[model samples]
Target: LMVLGLIGAVVLASGSLIKAISMIILGLLLGQINTDVISGTPRYSFDIPELTDGIGFVVIAMGVFGFGEIIANLGMPAEHREVFTKKVKGLWPTKEDFKEAWPAVLRGTGIGSLLGVLPGGGALLASFAAYTLEKKVAKDPSKFGRGAIQGVAGPESANNAGAQTSFIPMLTLGIPPNAVMALMVGAMTIKGIQPGPQVMSSNPTLFWGLIASMWVGNLMLVILNLPLIGIWIKLLTVPYRFLFPAIVVFCCIGTYTLNNSSFDVYMTALFAVIGYVFYKLKCEPAPLLLGFILGPMMEENLRRALLLSRGDWSTFATRPLSAGLLIAAAIMIITVILPGISGKREAAFQEAD
Candidate 1:
């Protein structure tokens, strides 16, 4: 938990979502190599039998995101609570607000669509990036944390676009970018459908129908959610003592159902304590969850790439596409290190209001 917590701390400190994600991938790859193929001996196992099977990503996610959220919320003071004001504003945006928001939504949707195609890039990253991008482009950036219209419109559109496009990789390329995609891949298998390029040709109706359904579902969600917005706002005003326990119970039940294992529940409790410590230390858990998911998969792919390249390290730099991606990654890292870059980034988030 502590190791994962450290990863999360680094991710939050880096101030670049993409940079943190890439680092998590690299870290997972590092943790994944368990055996020396030539020597035929366990390499990072430290003689622990459980280490051979590796850590469970589900456990980590439940601990970091599920329990962690509960702990963090518990630590917050009552004065920090946010409540909806009784003041009435029209449901529709003003003309100036619409003018500012429409372009932001379009840009966010485009960014979300493009990034959602990449492995490990999905709705969460897209939402964060979209919000950051909107703030960067806003004339009065100080209005953001203070209920800026662009902040809401941009991220909401980006998240929707990302949620839709994230399926492209799994449906077209047989690659699951995140855990949800992994589940979708399982669903395809259960339906006797191969998830690849042939899926489009062999299951054209299912493919096109799924795409059409996304549009219909999106429309329906808007229609359904608008009326329920007031209900959700009311939920926010519920006392923390009552609300937190309900959240805890739901999480515990969900975790138990994951494998019908009481061990998982116990582990969640342990993680909740760890998460509370993290809250006290002011560390974030998002990166840790990302790392926990990517670690084993990254190790497998890295090993395969090395084997295919005959262990040639230069393979990464020699391949045109790989080289280009590496260069882009390097530039991102350089930007993070340059003076004032980190400061300005933090300032944007700090001055969100």
Candidate 2:
């Protein structure tokens, strides 16, 4: 009991510290610095003036990072001897593939829609959970990871569904689901809008209109993706030589536009380089991203909870829910590294072989 208490305390402290640091670093990277506090500090220098409010982070993250990935993906030589360079398959799902995937799609959508409403996490978790669920419910249970339709369908639907529905709690309740929500609130504040429980009652049109637009936008996405599927398929058939450079160029331009500073372009390229290294290392970026986003909130909560507890440190364990989560996290950390860690994954791979 004593050892568990100590381990919990250390783990909680470390996680909170990391979260605080990440939030502060991300805020700086995105230009969310409040100058009033820093103006008096002689050592502090405002790097980018345009980052006065910090909304540019999402645009750059999406546009520039996305473009870089597209470019790199295009660079894998066509007809070359590389896993990522394999020839394109039939664009339309084959009958067998469709038969396998249809059920997983339905299941993933149902699970993801609910997970997205939770105020504490992001679509990343929803996607991971979707993948896990698909594997469990699969009739054959061996169709995963080998160009399985369900593998693609479940995560795609979950991520997309989560993207739209995540706005439910954010806009209506004014409680953030993830870092993006926090950034959205920051953006709203810049626009002279206030968020809270009353905002829904006070601004019915703004709230309802946002919700309505999401439905319309989702419909448009389906319509656009349907006709354009063929075009995108044709694009995949094109050789890598022409496509790769274009991707790199677009990413560079998008990154540069964020702060209108060349430094950010360089910074983006640096991260891209790191991304490629990570690709080689087989390190998952999902956790890294989640860690980065959660880093700040964790710190704030730890401090607030502790201060309220008068530094008792027992508050975390004293609260039933928090204690339960902390224990689960400990068990997960232990299980992830044990020999059984890769048992299922290895079995899956052998089946693939």
Candidate 3:
């Protein structure tokens, strides 16, 4: 619970506090749609059998990020839909650019490496945190959201580093730290490979090979991306009218295939509408996603802790580790809500506007 609170605080600091909290509350409510684990009774399932198993992550993700974005794009005026097709003179960075970027990259990597190990911390969280850190520490904070090289370098480096390190929890403890890692766990299960500490000893070859492949993959990306930049640029020239329909079709196909259920497709459409509402309200959906993912886990752990303590309700504070975590969470919330910090946060966001 404390970890989830801390994560929520970080997310809250990233944007408008009231909007973040509202989205998070909505996410928590949505997470309650399935059956209760402890009571073996239906929760907010509305007597629907299809909802008893809870909503799939893919459904929500595709609905909000895929269809919702498409809807927003379609709603905009045609004048706002112009693609940037300016010719590029150089693909590589200059020496001065490298010099400026390296320090940010190093800081981002360090931050990402640390955060990726935490439950629910992954590329998204790491990148957000890194960007916020860069903005806060920058000599001229106004440069952010204005083609600042530090803003780009920091977040990209953190994203890559966090993506690599997020495999740690899945590999060592069989606990996926993020959605991608959860998919990786599913893939490993299909391959008849259990993810845990035993894998290192029992399947050293597979374990070590996976680690080594990351380095190879990174090298391959650099080699391929440099030459493929033009192709990517050309892709942007495609009209939204031509591109969006294809994307919407693919999203529908993907959602329907998840369980071969038409209900899932309907649910996705519903959430897409909800997502569009959020978009209109300028509410970031990322924190809501984090809440949805962590909500059940937090409930389960809280229940287990209480059961073990015979419902004393003091186990959380009585334990040193949990106490420390709660303290940290409190400190983070206090820091974000302080008058001076809140004012600066608003100012920073306004600058971005």
Candidate 4:
């Protein structure tokens, strides 16, 4: 819960720009923050000379690994790519398929538009919820998870639509819709733009231009992804000997761009090693990312809540919403721990269906 709260705080703080770069840099550092499988343990300490709270580790790792990956990709021969680069499939969705997709797209758009206004909204959530809703809303519910066209349409559209709309809050209100947006806010602040409702009033060009660009960007993504999806799929079919280097190069370019420091590249390589190790060990990386990203902010919020309650422990359980959230957390924890116990509840739903 503490880690979750911290993640929430970071999400609320970081608005939706530079999501890619931050994900690369900060993500790597998070891998180093606490190697322990479990968070909130006193086993880890912040006494390391090089790792003063994991941010440096993240930056360094990002630079090295990202650059290394790019270098590796660049090393691949074009002649070798020719062996696998077959002609791609069609660029457009069929008219019948489009008909199947439109409703899901509409619903997803509605959900994303609403979610976009809220701070800390995530594209993944919008996508997942849209997917789940589509599953429920479909006439043939069983067709989903089996390449149903609507399943692909709604969540894909919603997540993209949500991602695009999330910029509105950052542009209009100066409040970040997510961590990426928060970084954008930082960049804007650095550029002497005070974000608020008045942003439109003061700089109609920036506001409107950005809005226009999003639609343009969507068009661009379609043009790019349609041809590239075939390519992406093709890459999977290519020999592993060629693929691993491409992965290394992609990581390197993305990571090195963070601060242009070679140290950051090396740091990224280090994290990649750690990530590989984690994969081998069968430990979950999701929680680690959540913990490292949210740790500092979580501590701040906990202290603030404590202050509000005059250091009373009961405050967490006393507030109506807070108490409800806590109860929900407990339910989630127990459900994950003992899913078998909920077998009857699951069967009841199946029977209801």
TM-score: which candidate is best? 3
lDDT, candidate 3, 1-353, per-residue tens: 43644354354444588887776767677778888889989888888999998998779989997899889888999866645546655657789889988999998898778667766556766776677677766767667655578898998888888888888888999999887889989998999999999989988998889889989999999999888877876766687788788888989999999899999999999989988988898777766776676677678788988898999888888888888888877777787789998898777676655
- lDDT, candidate 4, 270-329, per-residue tens: 666655544344332333443344444445566778878899989988888778767866
Per-residue lDDT of model 1, residues 1-353, tens digit only = 22322233242342455545554554465456455444466767768654454445555556766687777766678765444435444655579978878998898898678656656546765665577567666767767656788989988888889888989989889999877899999998998988998998999999999899998999899899887776666776676777778877888788788767777688678767866765565444455554544454445566788989999989978988778766765665667556687677666555643
State the TM-score for model 2: 0.64
Rank order (by TM-score, best first): 3, 1, 2, 4
Arranged by lDDT, best first: 3, 1, 4, 2
lDDT of 3 at 303: 91
Clashes of each: 2, 2, 0, 28
Tens-place lDDT digits, model 2, residues 52-86? 44333434344334543554555666565133345
**What lDDT score is found at residue 248 in candidate 3?**
88
RMSD of each: 5.8, 7.8, 3.8, 9.6
Cα lDDT, model 3, residue 157: 88
> Top lDDT: which candidate number?
3
Q: Candidate 1: where are CA atoms >4 Å away? A: 1-62, 76-79, 82-104, 118-158, 175-195, 340-353
Question: Better model by TM-score, 2 or 3?
Answer: 3
Candidate-wise lDDT, in order? 0.68, 0.57, 0.79, 0.58
Q: List the residue pairs that clash in candidate 1.
A: 142-353, 145-352
Clash count (model 1, backbone only): 2
After the best TM-score superposition of candidate 2, give how far the Cα of residue 184 lies from its true spot, in angstroms: 7.5
